[model samples]
Structures are given as C-alpha cells and as structure tokens.
Target: MLNDFSPAAAASSFSPAFSPPEVSQPAPPTFTSPAAAVAAAARLAPRLFEQAARTDEVGGFPTQEFAWLRETGLLTAALAPALGGAGLGEPAAALALLQVLYHVGRGNLAVGRLFEGHVNALLLIQRFGKPAQVAAYAADARAGHLFGVWNTENPAHGVRLNFLAGGTYRLHGAKTFASGAGHITRPLLTGALPAHHGWQMLVLPADEQPPQLDRSFWRPLGMRATASFIASLERLEISADCLLGQPNDYYQQPWFGGGAA
Candidate 1:
C-alpha cells in the first residue's frame, strides 16, 4: 500500500524530542500557482539548453542555470503553500511537478535530474522530518539554498555515522556519485549507523565543513555537467539537529519504494 504521507500522518509520527522552530519564517513570495511555477521554468528552458553544451566538461556545473532558477524562484516552488511555495510536490499538484521536470529535462537532463533530487529531498523532509526540521529546511529552500540528496556510496568505504555523547555523531567514510558536489550547499545524505541502528539521514551543510571532493571518481559517459563526485566526510562532527528523522526512516515503506518509482 502507498504510504499515508499527508500532513496529519507526518505530525502523528513526530517524536517528542523535536520541537517546533522558534524563529518565525519571513513572509514568502506570494504563493506561486502550479501553472505559474511551470511557466517560469518553461521560460528558462532555452537558456538552460544554451548553457548545457558549454558545461559538459569534467567537474562542470550549471552555476548560471541555477542562478537563473533562483532568480525565477523555482527552487522554493516545491514547498507547500503555507511555507511560501506553489505546493508542487503535494498530492494535489503531483502532475505539475512531472510537467516541470519534463520541460526542464527537455532543455537539460542533468539539470532536470538535479532539480528532481532537490524537490524529492524537500518532499521527504516534509513527510518524515519533525516540524522544526521541516520549517528550517523550507526556509533554506526559500533562502535559495541549493539542496540535493546523496545516497550512493562505495561498498567498502560507505558513509558511516558513529554515535557520540550528547546527540553528536562522528562520521567516517564518503559518498560517491554525489551530484553537484561542490555547489550543493545543503545536501541530504544517508549514513549507516552502528549497533544495527540502520541508516540515518542527515542534513549536511557542505559549505561549512567542506568535504574532501574528488572529481576524478566521476567519469560519466555523458551528462558531464552533473558534477557527481566522491565526497569524503571523514571525522565530520554533527549535532542532533542535523538528523532528519528517526533511524531507518529513509527506507521506510512506500516513501522509499515510491520515491524510487
């Protein structure tokens, strides 16, 4: 059965450990309707296409394309209306996201993939994160933080999180094929936990503690602009706030299988 990922379901599953965000979010841009959101992306298609060819090099990223996306406010459009977005990822506007992805892919597939990852990351947070985590990440989206989801890793050197005292974690290992490596500031990463705790999802601020980026690890036949690289996060210390949801929430039910679909 499909997961009941509605707002009510999300709140019902929240843990007592998490509290709502104290800082009130500033008023977001007047809610962009789904049509308007898609239209804005459509307007930028040609420009994205024009730049795609130039960025097809090793470690290349669509920086200008993302700038235009931020300028057009598409980055935050995945959030719900209450959070100052167009509700693109909500159940009601599901088709709108597909249409937006289609248009974006028509121009540049790599950008489309990265955009999908961004939207999916936000969607997951809304569905699985605590109220505070959701609100904070939504604010980041509105503030033009480029978000990404990094899950893949080498089998032998996979990302691992060692629990420490006082809700802190000591990370060891790295993530491979991490898209938009250097450019993605807020990356939602998954790491294996010790003592059979399953995997944990973390909202990493790569900009603050930059990972060891190895571009040589990514040798794609095409879509070179993805900039997927190996990012070693060895010894990175993170607080409890970085945790997105409970342990193993990432692979839970329809949310996990459904996301893959």
Candidate 2:
C-alpha cells in the first residue's frame, strides 16, 4: 500500500540536485513530408530495440533510452515546425505520427507507451491550451522534456483539485497505474473539482517532490520497463499556469465522447 505523506515531508526527502537540469534549445530539424519523418524513425529503430531488450530485463525506468531519444530529436517529431519540431506537415501528418509510433512500439512497447503519451500531450496543448501554454510546453519538448498522461484514480480516494485561497490549486488523493511515475518530467492528470461539479486537467512536474510510490502495484510480466506505480499526491501545490483545458473539457463530445475514441 502507498502511504500518503504531507507535502512538507515529501519536499524534505528530495535533494535539489535530483531535479532535472534545464535543457538548452536545439536547432529544429526540417522534414519536407510524412515520408521524411518515417525515414527518421526507421533509422532510429535499431538503437531503440537494443535498449528495449535491456530495459525489459531490468524492469525499471528506461532513462538511458530516453536520453538517446532526446539527442536524436525523435521525441518531438510530431510537433509542428513553429514549435521547434521536425515539420511533418499535414494531409498525412496523422499517418506519419502513427508510423513513428509503430516503429517505436516495435522496438519497445514501454518506451512506445511513453512516447505516445508525449505526443498526446503535445496535441492537447496544440488544440486546447492557450498560446502561452502551448509555447511553454513546446519549448519544454524542444528542450527534451518528456510528457505523460495519468488519469487512473483510486475509487476510495479519488483525486481532487481544490482551489486554494491564493488563486492556486492543491491536489489531494492518488492516481493508480501511473506510467513513468518518476521519470516523466511533465505529467498531465485529471481530477474532480469541489462540489462534484466537473473535472479539470492539469500538468505538473512529477519530480518536484518525492511522490510516495507503491512499486508493487504494477506486477505485469510484459512491458515491465514502464515502471508504472501508484502515486500519492496529498496537498501538492499547483500553479495557476499548470491548468490545461477548462473544467469538464476532458469529457467533451465529438472528440472524446464521440466516435473519435
């Protein structure tokens, strides 16, 4: 079982040096079309596979593999050029994105899961987030920050987004089956607001504090490298800028409620 701890206690356990360093911006690559993006993924296949085998055996985080992804610029290939990505222009952008994911999945399912979430986070920011939010996250991706989404909640202690007096918010409760629990830089999660009104989506730095992890919660024999864990987030302060879409936006129709799923 994952024991909950106060924010202060969690803060005390972490060293400042554990925080990820700020990454410098790298020059964006130019991709004329979807085919170009596919080719790049093809070139990276061997390396991704080589690392995947080791990660699966170890059953921990794939840190070194992630670094390789960052260095190769394959992590941000799905974003638009303006966002410092390899410009995989549309009409075939969706197909191109799928191709990249397929190749990555072939190499390693766990890393592929993380990469897929990263792409989803970028797409969410592109579609619903404010201009500034989009730019900030895009810059982070360009700087090699990995993103993920964690929506699973514990029924006994569902996650809540409580509005604070200072115009900020604090998270309470835990998310279960959270993949890349410790390694993901920016993780997008959903929680219910007060009064049972609606849900809200927010992004926060996963490594800011040492989140209590129930490592044993994940016992799958396959994709063990994912490092999925139960995360207890009790009284975790959240900045105003971290809020992504509006309340209940996560369940909106046509996109989520409709056939798009």
Candidate 3:
C-alpha cells in the first residue's frame, strides 16, 4: 500500500527555523494553458535546434537556450497561481507538463533533462514544503532561477548531513551525476543523517559557494549539454528551514517507489 504523506502532514512535523533570502518576483506569466505553453515552446524549438550542434560539440552546459525558456515563461508554468505561477490546475497539469517536456525534448535531449529536473524539484516543494518555503521558491522560479534534483550518490564519499548547534545542519561529501551542476540555482539533494538512519532531503543554493565539479567525469557521446558532474558539497551549511519533511522521508516506502512511478 502506498503511504500517504501529504504536504500538510509534512509541514506539521517540522517547524520553520529560518526563512529563505528574499527574491524579486518576475512579471506575470504570458501563457496559462498547456497548449499555449507548448505553442510557445514550439516557436522556440528551431532556435534551440540551431544551437544543438554547437552545444553537443562543446560537451558542456547549455546556457543560451535556457534564457529563451525563461523568457517564454515555460519554467514557471507548473507552479500554483498563489505562488506567482500561471495556475495550470490539475486534471490538466500532467498533460501540460508532458507537452512542455515533449516540445523541449524534440529540440535537445540534454536541455529536456534539465528542465525535467527543474519541474521535479518544484513538484517536491509543492508537495512537501511549508507555505513560506513554497512562496519563496516560487518567487525565485518566477525570476528565472533554475532548480534541480541531485540524488545520485558516490560510493567512495557518501553524502552526509551533520546537525549543528541552534537547529541548523551542515552537508558534507558529494553527489555524483548531478545534472546542470554549475547552473542549477537551487538543487534538492539527499544526504544521510549523522548518527541517524535513512536520508534527508534539502534544497540549497547550488552555486552559493563554488562547488567542486569534476568536469572529466562526464564524457557521454549523447546528451552532452547536460553538464552532469560530480559536485563536492563539503561543509555546506544549511539552515533549518532548508530541510524538507523529516529523517527517512526521502526513501519513505510506497511514496518513493509508488509515487515516483
């Protein structure tokens, strides 16, 4: 049976200990429906394709196309209206998200992957984050900030979270196969808790301090523009509010397996 871990339940379990830094909000979304968003994506596809060859040849991050995506308001469409988004409500959200991904995927798989991660991060926040957290992240998203989910772990140096004084946490070690490494503004990462079993999920500024990226690690023949790299988060301090849910929440039985499916 799938475990029902609702946002309200998650919020009730933890109290906010800090607030995210303020961010200026962007202009209102230009498109509201999936069809309109997809249409806009279609209009941008050719330009993205034009840069695909170079982006692949460079074998690094895809920067130019993302600017177009942000300008078109495709990145913030999935967010709820209360959070400064286009308000593409349910029964249609899945289809809308699918269409957006499909159109972008047609232009470049690497960019599509990054965009998919961004959407996943936003959904996780929407599902488990408190109201303040949601609003803050929404504003960041609206302002063209990119989000990513980096869960892959390194066997040699497993990611760990150390509890600090005053209810804060510090992240040590690194995560491998982290996509959009340098470019992802806020990334949802997983770390094992010190002296505690299971993992914790956290959202932090990926580039707040320079992350150690092993550029030599990714040499894929395809999806070269993804910039998937090894990021060392040694001694990265995380405020209490950045922690989502509770210990073991990340791998919580049916939710991790079933909900993801």
Off by over 4 Å in 3: 1-28, 87-91, 252-261
> For residues 1-261, what per-residue lDDT tens digits would candidate 2 score against the true structure?
444523343323322111343654454454656677788777877888887767774346677777666666776776777676764424347677778878877877888887777777676667668999988888777776778778887677778988889898988888887777767778888888899878888888666744665656676775777867777777788888999889888766644532122
Total backbone clashes of model 1?
0
For candidate 1, the 10 contiguous residues with the lowest summed lDDT are 10-19
Model 3 lDDT tens row, 166-204: 998877777778888767778888889877667888898
Candidate 2 residue runs with Cα over 4 Å from true position? 1-30, 57-59, 87-91, 253-261
* True lDDT of residue 167, candidate 2: 91
Q: Alpha carbon lDDT of residue 8, candidate 3?
A: 25
* Cα lDDT for residue 110, candidate 3: 86
Show model 1 residue runs off by greater than 4 Å. 1-31
* lDDT (CA) per prediction: 0.76, 0.71, 0.71
The best candidate by lDDT is 1
Sequence-dependent TM-score of model 1: 0.85
Query: Please, what is the TM-score per model?
Result: 0.85, 0.85, 0.83
Clash count per candidate:
0, 0, 0
